[model samples]
Target: MILTKQHLQNNFAKARETNSPYVFVGIKAEGVSEVIVIPKKSFDAKEQFYMNAYSEDLTHVMNNNVMITGLSYGDADQIPNII
Candidate 1:
C-alpha cells in the first residue's frame, strides 16, 4: 500500500509498541521518487534506508562498503554516522 507521513508515523508507533522493525516500500505522488525501508537501529532508519538506497547506484558500489546504521523517527540527517 502507499504510505503517507501519517501512515509511516502510525506504523512506527506500532513498531515501537511491538519492539519490531517496520519495513516497506513507498513511491511518492510525483512517481519519480521512490523509497525502501529496512531494519536499522533507529526509527528514522526508514528514511536513511531510503536515502542510502536512493543516493547511489548499488550496481557500482561495493556491498561491504555500505553500512546499515540505526533509524531515527525524526529526520534522516539527524542521525549520527558511526563506523
Candidate 2:
C-alpha cells in the first residue's frame, strides 16, 4: 500500500498528541523495502516543518498496522536488507 502525504501527516499528528511512535513500511525499490519508526517529536517536527510530499509502501500481509516487514533475517542482519 502507498501512504499519501496527508495520511502521514494525520498519523503524525495523532502520534504527537499521544506521545507514541508511528511505524510504517515502505518499499524502497523492487524487491527491497524498509521499516520506518517515527517518534512523536520527530513526527511532529517533520509534519510541521517539511513541506515536501512523502509516501510509504507496505506489504500485503502487514496491512495498516504497526508491524514492518521485508528486513533480512540472516547472520549479518540489517533491519531493511533485502533477501
Off by over 4 Å in 2: 22-25, 48-83
Q: Model 1 clash pairs?
A: 41-70, 42-70, 42-71, 43-71, 43-72, 44-71, 44-72, 44-73, 45-71, 45-72
All models, RMSD in angstroms: 13.0, 9.8
lDDT of each: 0.41, 0.41
Q: Which digits, one per residue and each the tens of the lDDT, describe model 2 over residues 18-59? A: 555443333343444455444444654655542343324322
Error of 2 at 44 (Å): 2.8
Q: Kindly provide the TM-score of model 1 when superposed on the true structure, using C-alpha atoms.
A: 0.35
lDDT of 1 by residue, 1-83 (tens): 32234444565666566666544443332224334454536567654444445423221123434322322333333233210
Report RMSD for candidate 2. Answer: 9.8
